[model samples]
Target: MPEVVVITGGSRGIGRATALRFARRKGIRLALVARDETALAAAADACRARGAEVLTVSADLAAPDGPERAADAVVARFGRIDVWVASASVFSYGSVLDTPDEIVDRVIQTNLTGHMRAARAVLPHFHARGGGTLVFVGSLFSQIPGPYVAPYVAAKHGLLGFTRALRQEMLGHRGIHVRIVLPASIDTPIYERAANVTGRTPFPLPPVVSADRVARAVVRAARGGRAEVAVGAAQLVTRPLRFLAPRVFDRFIWTLQRTLGLRHRPAADTTGAVLAPMHDPGAVSGGWSRVPLRHPRSRRR
Candidate 1:
């Protein structure tokens, strides 16, 4: 039987690349899910051109039933799901104090709750088959605290806890596989979306890896059954910085925010078009893009 794989946020960036890569592999079926119908169809078309079975599900994973609907749609079409990849995420960058309650809530509900819901929806099917792999497309922000994007950082950090707890619960469980892939920065539309929230440009992390690189890593994790993998040096450095100087790191982040003129904009609500102090996505291609380099928004000079 061809392996059936479900990928959220499959319209663009790493998710799209992963779906495309898997579609090219023989004996692999794909279900692509995202909120954008147009992007999802485009992604599905690309995957279909590769001679792989492809289904596109347009659903908001942040809504209560969005995850369930996406999972059910995939299972209904493919019959069985061999892999579930949670890649759909909303990016925001702003001070917790200034960010609206709605933004904060939405971020958690989408990034964390959506994953939980998707996993729950698929676990039964996975167990029924006696085995399956769960791949989490988490960010390096999950490991370290970022200054301006407090809500996003918090959600990512919470995901790490969720990942670890779930790992402990599922380890050695009959044929179940769970893993996390942390990527520092990849060139994607996510940067632009994040800019809307944080008013920042999306740049590579001084040496940004391509979305293809992260996609390849996802494929490798799915094949090798690795517990966790980090895709870039930005994560490599940030992980240790958290442990080495916790207070200093926080202070550094504070100083950077102060120095970069990046702070919560004076706005009553962040729901609509509110011009907030923003920074670039920070070297998403790992400093390889044409965008001019700027000081870190979360780090001091």
Candidate 2:
């Protein structure tokens, strides 16, 4: 029997790339879940052409019963789920006081609670089967702090703790594993689609890693690997900086976010993909690699 994989947020980004990678291997079946139907269809078709059985579920993971329904649908089609990837998350930018309540709630609901719901939906099956692998696609923000993205950072921190707890709980099951991949500034469409009310346009920082690279990490975790895998070389340095020199880390990260993360270019206040899906959900890569990273100075300055 082929291995069954259920991936959330499969419409684009790391999830889509992971699906394609798994499709390349023999004896694998994929079920892609996300809100964008058109993009999901495109991703599913691509995976099918790669010769892997594919099932696309167009559902929002933030919804109350969305994960449960998706899990049911996957089991109905694939019989069993061997791997579950929790990558369905939304992004937003603004200080806590500056961002609206609903936006923050949505980000937490989708990024943190959404993953929790997925665990609830799948753990029972894993327990029954005596084994399964659960991978959570987190961010470097899970440990290090950055300015203007407090809500996202908070959600990731919570996600990391939750994953740790799950891993501890699954210790008894020999075949069960809980893994988390923390990538720093991946070139995903998240920056373009994220809700921004800070007036300044946001962009991924220097050395933006490719989404496929992050996907490969996820693939390794699913197969068998370390419990925690942090992508990007900078992640290694940042982790220690947080402990060795807390003040220096704070000032350095804040300066970098101000100078490199957000552009001085003014952006009108409009919720981008916060309350709903993106208008044009682009492909896996956000093309940030082509654009050189520079200190975006204001014309007035």
Candidate 3:
């Protein structure tokens, strides 16, 4: 029997890349869940081309029953789920006070609550099977919060707490594993799809890692059952800095956000993909590599 994996946010970004990565492994079946039907179908087709059996579920994970329904459908199709990847997330760009209540709630629901729901739906199956892996695709923000992304930062922090607690609960269950992969800013459509309240366009801090890097880490976690893995050189340094000098690190992050995180070019304030599925399905990369990296001082001049 093949290993069956169900991945949320599988339509694009890290989820899509992870699906493709798993496709390379022989005898792996995949069920992809996301809101965009077109994108989900495209992802499933791509996986199938790589010779992996694929199922696409177009469901808004923020919906109360969405995660459970996806889990049920996957089990029905594949007989069992060996691994579950929680990677679906929506981005928000604004101060907590500036961002609308709806956007904040949506971000929290999609990024944090959705994962909880997925876990709830899968835990019973894992208990019955006597073994399974759960991988949460978190961010470096899970440790150190950044400015102008209050909702995202909060969600990541909550996710980390959730992962830790769940891991502790499964301590004696040798067959069950809970893992988390925290990646630094990856070149993904999240920046484009983020709800932007700032007058300027939102951009990730420099040295953006590729989605493939994060995807590979997630795959490794699933196979190795590592408790937690943080990807990227920046993440390595940031974690230590955060621990060594809390206030200084906070100031540094604030400076970096004001300088490198936003561009002066005016962009119309829109909810991006937080509220609705994007009309055009996104790919893994946001093409940030092509954009020249500008220094903060250079932007001012």
Q: lDDT of all predictions, in order shown?
A: 0.73, 0.87, 0.89
Model 3 error, position 104 (Å): 0.4
Candidate numbers, best lDDT first, in rank order: 3, 2, 1
Q: Write the per-residue lDDT of candidate 3 for residues 154-188, one digit (tens) a residue.
A: 99999999999999999988799999999988888
Best by the lDDT measure: 3
Error of 1 at 2 (Å): 0.5
Clashes of each: 21, 0, 0
* TM-score to true structure, per model: 0.85, 0.95, 0.95
lDDT of candidate 2 over 1-301, digit per residue (tens): 7999999988788888888888998978999999988889888888999999999898888899999999999999988899999998788888778999889988999999989999999998888888899999999999887888998999999999999999998888888889999998888778878889889988887778888999999999998979999998778788899999999999998898888788787887767887888635447876676664732232234
Error of 2 at 263 (Å): 0.9
All-Cα superposition RMSD per candidate: 5.6, 2.7, 2.8
How far out, in Å, is residue 282 in model 1?
20
Number of residue pairs clashing in candidate 1, backbone atoms closer than 3 angstroms, sequence gap of 3 or more or interchain: 21
